[model samples]
Target: MFDWLQHIADWLVYDVFNLSTEQHLANALNFFIYDTVKILILLFVIIFFMGIVNSYFPVDKVKNYLSRHKLYGLEYLMASLFGVVTPFCSCSSVPLFIGFVRGGIPLGVTFAFLITSPLVNEVAIGLFIGLFGLKTTLIYIVSGILLGTISGVILQHLKLERYLTPWVKDVLAQAQREQHLFEAEQLAFKQRLPIIWAEVKKILKGVIPYVVLGIAVGGLMHGYIPEGFFEKYMSKDNLFAVPVATILSVPMYSNASGILPVVQVLVSKGIPLGTAIAFMMGVVGLSLPEAMLLKKVMSLKLIAVFFGIVTLCIIISGYVFNVIL
Candidate 1:
């Protein structure tokens, strides 16, 4: 199906520019061209459909279900699953987090949703399948959901409600008293087009720079990195490799789609599959931008705890995959 697209890229690079694909510079340019076109096309189609689905599912209903449930295990599970479909970026996820907290949802359950939303975005899943195949894609999805669910359940058990920011506690208390409810507004079918278009534009604007940067870095790594660089340092036999990858991923700002190309190159160059996957998850699931955004509503201590727990889980997952795979 994609043969024609590859032909077009090849034609432009080889025929038009007279550049040989065997050259490192030409290879990098071809990588950039193919990935940019493919990702942008996927982004537009998937995000547009996601917008339509999101519009149909009113936030009030979502909040009500999540908040009213006291069944901790079930709620966490549901929140993690719900996150798979929501596909929110880090900044947008914050408002939903606030609403969840305000609606009296447990912090842990809300955190579950927050963790999975970006990690389990449809675009990421689709790209993973395309780039890494089905088994790896399933591993990513299942592990991502499990991470969110387990982290949320642990936080709930620890009774960490007191660790929230003072303002968040105040808001929650006020919400409990006032019991403000969200009323669902039904929009006409035609009205939905503009909403979807706006969302598509907003999403594209936010992600384009990261996508470009990620592809550029990936292109360079694909073309120019020494073949044995990762094999020497990040092989499965290196006990510290998983931990290092997990730690490095936390501060990275790129989304899963942005970083997958580089990860592909890393794995092709002989980085352990588990280590590469761990790094990809870290970048997508936890980031400096996400922490800064969450800071508005969470105490610094709580943020630290959240980051620590997630990092630990990712490291464990990496090691397990390394041993098993």
Candidate 2:
């Protein structure tokens, strides 16, 4: 199947399209444009439905149910599982975080949701399945959720609630200010569709540039990078590969969906699956943007702690996958 697809790809580029050196460059440009357009369309449809779900459902109910303080482990599991179904990015997760905080959910459980939401989203899962097959995708999903739950429970045990910014705490305290704001606004579902559409537009405006840049870079690396370069740096035999990948991925920002294709190429070139997976997770979950955004609600100390915990989790997950797979 892959050979057939590659044959078609070659025919289109080398025969019908007659791509020369200059044409290859143009084709690359066109690839980026097409990729950006496709990703924007997908994001719009997915987020529109998510917005409707957010508006119609009582998010407070989930918060309240999870806040009862009965079973920390179970609550963490549920939070992580919930994240798998919800399609939210770091920015989108903020409002839900605020709602969870205002609804009196435990700080640790809320952190679980925050961690899992970006790391193990449906789009990421689908892309993984398509690129890497079911086994690898399942490993990614399971490890991500495990990391979220474990990190949340650990943070709760540390009692680091005091590290939150004072203003954020105040926002939680003033929860009644906008309670029922959505419920009181009476609009038919059809009428509400436009609002969701507008949100999709705004989000795409912000996200498209990053997606374009990331994919273009990935395509260049895919087409031109030396096959053995990543293999030499990130082979299973290299003890330092996992941690190195995690550290290198910190400044970079791409979700799993954006990184999966690049990762497929890396694996084909003999890069260890564990190292590639760790790099992908770090890019999505521990980005500079996420850290900066989190600073609005947390002190530098808390942000540092969050990064450290996630980095450690990714490293450990890498090693585990290396051993098992």
TM-score of each: 0.63, 0.65
What are the lDDT figures for the candidates, one per model?
0.71, 0.69
Would you give me the overall lDDT of model 2? 0.69
Q: What local lDDT score does residue 33 receive in model 1, on the 0 to 100 scale?
A: 79
Q: Which residue ranges in model 2 land beyond 4 Å of their true spot? A: 1-69, 176-232
Model 1: CA > 4 A from native: 1-72, 176-237
TM-score of predicted structure 1: 0.63
Point out the worst 10-residue segment of candidate 1 by lDDT: 175-184
**Per-residue alpha-carbon lDDT of candidate 1 for residues 137-175, written as tens digits (9 for 90 to 100):** 898789989998998888877778888877666544433
- Residue 325: error of model 1 in Å? 2.3
Q: 146-241 in candidate 2: lDDT tens per residue?
A: 999999999888888899888556654433322344568867787767765665565456555555565566445334443334445677667899
